[model samples]
Target: MTVGYVMLCHTALDRAAQVARFWAEAGCPVVIHVDARVSDKAFASFGRVLGDLANVSFSRRYRCEWGTWSLVAASLAASEQLIARHPEARHVYLASGSCLPLRPAQDLADYLAKRPDTDFIESVTTEEVGWTMGGLDIERFTLRFPFSWKRQRWIFDRYVDLQRRLKIRRRMPAGLVPHLGSQWWCLSRATLKAILEDPERPAIDRFFRRVWIPDESYFQTLVRQHSRKVESRSLTLFKFDYEGKPHIFYDDHLQLLRRSDCFVARKIWPNAERLYRSFLEPQEGVQIRAEPQPGKIDRLFSKAVERRQRGRPGLYMQSRFPRRDHENGKTSSQYSVFQGFAELFDDFPGWLTRATGVGRVHGHLFAPEGVEFAGGERLANGALTADASLRDYNPQAFLTNLIWNTRGERQCFQFGPRDHQGVDWFMATDPNAQISVISGAWSVPLFRSDLPFATVRAEAARLQRIETRYLEILRSMYVKARVRIWTMSDFIENPMEPLQAIVDEISPRAARRLTEPPQMVDLTGFGRFLQNLRNEGMKPTLMGDFPVNGDPRIAAPRGRRPYLVQ
Candidate 1:
């Protein structure tokens, strides 16, 4: 059986080398995605240790989002390219940037030879409603982010406090719901192809646009939908303490890794040296594949950031709260509706109002701007509106409408039904321009309405000008940083057809050589721009918010941006 190992990577070049070395010894073909933010010098520095093995290849460099589809998209793109490069690749396993092989590659090949048809991915029916990061939402399936927002330091503390004081009950956006699970996945080539060649790919794409972390779900949910037989549990090792962070592999956790019966466990810090050795130690009657011990570096690495809770007297305390757990697995529409406003108004109301020009913005929840009494509607602001649609909408009718709109034949982007209420549909176009206006990361609900189009377009144009001006101001910064790629905040999510048209219109001038020689962040029509640039014999670097895979690439570590120090 032909087996392929897909290594989805971001940082820790030394550890990546160790893992790659282990897999190389197993004779498994390996592909790695090096993040783009890593300096060329740094990548070259690590390349010596990583060495060139016949089985190992590096991905084109790209930056990755923390909890979005970028992660999944990057992986899928890498897998597609990997298969294209090595057609003999058979079983493709999605391993994290920080994963190591527990068994010989040949042993894994033998194991898969026994079940060619069965995909080892974790999958389940939407009916089961199991442990998803966001309950039943497409966001759970489409988005990718290297860092956990819930685990990150208090970037949104005021919102959390406001939520507690208001005792607010949020619901899923109007058309979107959430489904969450483990991000690590393994799959057969057939299943992987089905995902890439899905006839309803547009529908899936739309669905995940609103889903939280499409990276984790894109393959998982699709395999469950298309494949006949699937294992519901992710085969890799993933265990969490009460706080929901994966128990970092410290020396103390070595015994536990041996007994867990898992294929891999994330995320060892680069500092861990001893754990790598322990993984090589032999145990009585334990086959290499079934052995429980960790690699030598596993024990010596410091605790993963996931395990650390930077507590303060009043600022932060790690809690076993449902919200924290659900942040990874589930998010209610009630919560998201409030969260939409929270991310907007609570954190930086002035900046938002100035950008969107919404006067007296208290909390512009996307409650249906219509008069209605039934189906979870309430009279507020002298007009009757629903706080959310799906909350009490007719389920059968609602689901039918959602599915219908999401049909591939439709011209406009159509995400399916809401996993929650009052939010956008399960899949929606990204609010790229509005996101730029608000100076926030890509998120749904920011562009949940058709009404925002004119405003968004206007703001997008203005922002382009502003961005151009900002680029001019930062010319020195760009030069000093040696940045070859520039990411734009000007793109908006919605009706991608027009966006593609825009990309075709302006992609050329945007990529024209800057005075300093760095590539400008191509907006809208980047897909064609990339082609056009290549045709012009100008190999301009791409700085997409999402990941792309081929050859080899490197990304900067999260929180370790060159501009900032921890």
Candidate 2:
């Protein structure tokens, strides 16, 4: 016996007619079900196009809505008609209007003839199903969904919530266990007749009328009671994304669909001329009699789902702008943020470039004037301009874009209290940032400036407050960056070790040790600068204890020479 097709059409009646004609010409009886929503003129034209086929017939019209009882009712009516009219048809394949046959119809008939009793339908218990979306699994069976989810979402949600709060649950019809799977299925004639003619069908239908998306579970659950042998898989290749939406096939998916070896695939683009022309036309030569293997393309669909959900790290695009703290990765690659280094050293950027042997070092990128890109270029990588206003508009995007654009190369930039402090918390929370901070180094610039003592003292108080608040953020529990903080007084005592550690972390692959360290600016009168600030009633707390005499580097004279006792 040949296979019979029961197609459910809602839109794109032209394409549906084409597929129906193709199946009817292949000696398979066709039964079509049109949604009542279609215009009368369109329905008449659709019927006229397929009226030449004697085997093709239209079932009773039903107004179908997604996630409601209408779809199940439509399928029931169409399937019953298909079974009665085409009694020679041993198997009934339920497909959608958009489903295109990927293999020859005769090949499918041959495959089914071998396994006459086997019913191909995806059936699994709620506990075993992991692909359910919308937080509804067992609740779908237990809860009552009377309102349309698409049209009356507000009422639907409130009704579901009200039912949940009141703890209302409906009893399932006795002698039947609920099962879930893809709506599409290929059932044997015996099983279809058994499900349609069951004495308790009226009760089962009444119970499932209030169920959510009953079309998926109606046939799937009932088939278990009637079918002697169930394969627990669909002959049709249907795939959904992270969101519960089906993946639509286009012309570009020609090879992808061919590799699946599935008898039919659904949700094809109506305008994909290439896909329709290539798949609808008969495939010649020896046909592969292998079983339908949807798993062959599962990896590609998994990647597509992952890419749609998590997206590429550090990429901020219109399609996917992740919520705060929800990014796959805050930055694309590793980078360095040096605080107080530029203020305490004469030529820190130049020295760092020479030390690393890679000249990817820039001055304060967030300088109030403009972005100080390397070599003072007007535009940086990714066509990022040096406009201060634009950079300040979105400092976080600027930094992320910089790191993303220069992914292969490591980025190094200087930061200080004088520059914009917008990205302080962002850098501290980013795992890719390597921050080296020398506390209270902002006072150095004030000390050497030829300004009045009152002016220096006022500026020192302002900067000291900003730095103190910044240090608190870095020390907080939420910080993810690699942080190394040293008091200015302590860093001056041993600069080589910290420099070596910072350089080593930046370039771990470099086998050589740091032989040439950045030259430190002379701190002859720096100690007096802090003592002077303290004298002005402003406590310089961030900087470690300093000798009030002057420079901490100078050695004190001894009253008598001491001899070592050996």
Candidate 3:
């Protein structure tokens, strides 16, 4: 006993004919159902092309609309014809027009012949099925779906909602529980005949007519009652995406299909000439007779779904720009932001490059004039230009691109109240950011500037206000960055410890004890500067307590002089 194929063809009749001829030439009866939507001229031509094959026949035509009863009717007509016309056929395999045979017809027939009484179909109760889309589970069976979900979505949704609100539910025909699965299945002759010729078939069909996507549920549920043995899986390889849409295989999937070992694979791209040629043409060597294992390639499909949903971290592409706070990672890699470091240290960028053993350090990147790229280049990695107009247009994108482009290298850049503050919150929330802040350090530049006292006072107040607001954001509960804050007075008292900690965090694997420290800009009269600001009616609270004695450094406590050991 051989296997007969019942194909549902809605488009690409030529490809259907090709596959049909392949099966018929292998001694299997083929019954095809073409959708009524096809033009008469096309249907007549399709029929003439296959008219030479006596084993091939066409069933009654039906206008099959997706997610409607017409699809079930078309399948029923085709299945009935396949059973009656081909008495020698032991099993009926359902397939779609786009499906291509991945293995030889004899292999599939031999496989089915081994399990003559076994029906291969995916059958599971609705409660156990987690793959259903559209938020309909058991409700798909209880609620009447008169409107087409695709064509009349508005009415379909409203009708479902109205039924839900009024608590209307339909009763299932006795002895049948709702089951859902893939539409492609292979049923033994006994099960197919029993389901089609059952005495209660009229009642069962009438009830399932209003069930949403009944083609997937009709045979899947009835086979449990009629079949003596069920394999609970399909011989065809069918995969759906996160959105419940089938993944169409193209020419590039040639090797992927061969690895599945499935008898047939569906939803192939119509123009995939390579796939058709490679899969349809029989291989002349010894064929592997292992069972079909679709699970072998499941990892590839899972990764494809993950990449489509949550893209690689910190990548902002035109095709998949994520919403705010919804990114997998705000920035691609870890980087350092030095707030107030440049002002307090002489040649800070150069010193940092040496200390961290990294070469990507730069001056204030968000400076008003232009981006201070490493070595003052006009452009940076990933062709990121130093044009201030473009950088300021989207400061967040500029910074994210910088980190993404310079990945695998630790990037260090200075930031201050003087630079653009647009990216304040972004850096504060990014987990990849390592921010070392010294409050009131912005006043150091003002004091060192040769400007008038009045101008310095006004400028200090503005910078102070910006830094205060920025500090508030850093201290907020939403912050994810690794932060270390020290006031100007506090940092001067003990600076080496904080610097060592920052460097170690940036390059933990290669970090050693700090033997050489960056030279601090002389703060001899810096205390007087703070005292002067306080005396000028502008209180500088962010600087902490400063001694009026003019010296900012506190000498380390010294031990008593050591005497001779004798």
Predicted model with the maximum lDDT = 3
- TM-score leader: 3
Please give the lDDT score for candidate 1.
Answer: 0.47
Roughly what TM-score does model 2 have, to 2 decimal places? 0.93
Query: Could you give candidate 2's per-residue lDDT for residues 3-38 as a string of tens digits?
Result: 999999999999999999999999999999999999
List the lowest-lDDT window of 10 residues for candidate 2. 549-558
Off by over 4 Å in 2: 133-135, 139-143, 165-167, 512-515, 545-566
What would the per-residue lDDT of candidate 1 be over residues 177-296, giving only the tens digit for each residue? 343456777777887887788777777676665455566556766776566578666667655543445655665666556565456677665565666666643334656555333343
Any idea how many clashes model 1 has?
96
Count of backbone collisions within predicted model 3: 0
Q: Is candidate 1 or candidate 2 better by lDDT?
A: 2
Worst 10 residues of 3 by lDDT: 548-557
lDDT (C-alpha) at residue 153 in model 3: 91
* Preferred candidate (lDDT higher): 2 or 3: 3
Per-residue alpha-carbon lDDT of candidate 3 for residues 100-150, written as tens digits (9 for 90 to 100): 999999999999889999999999999899998989989989999999898
Candidate 3 displacement at residue 248 in angstroms: 1.1
lDDT of 3 at 234: 92
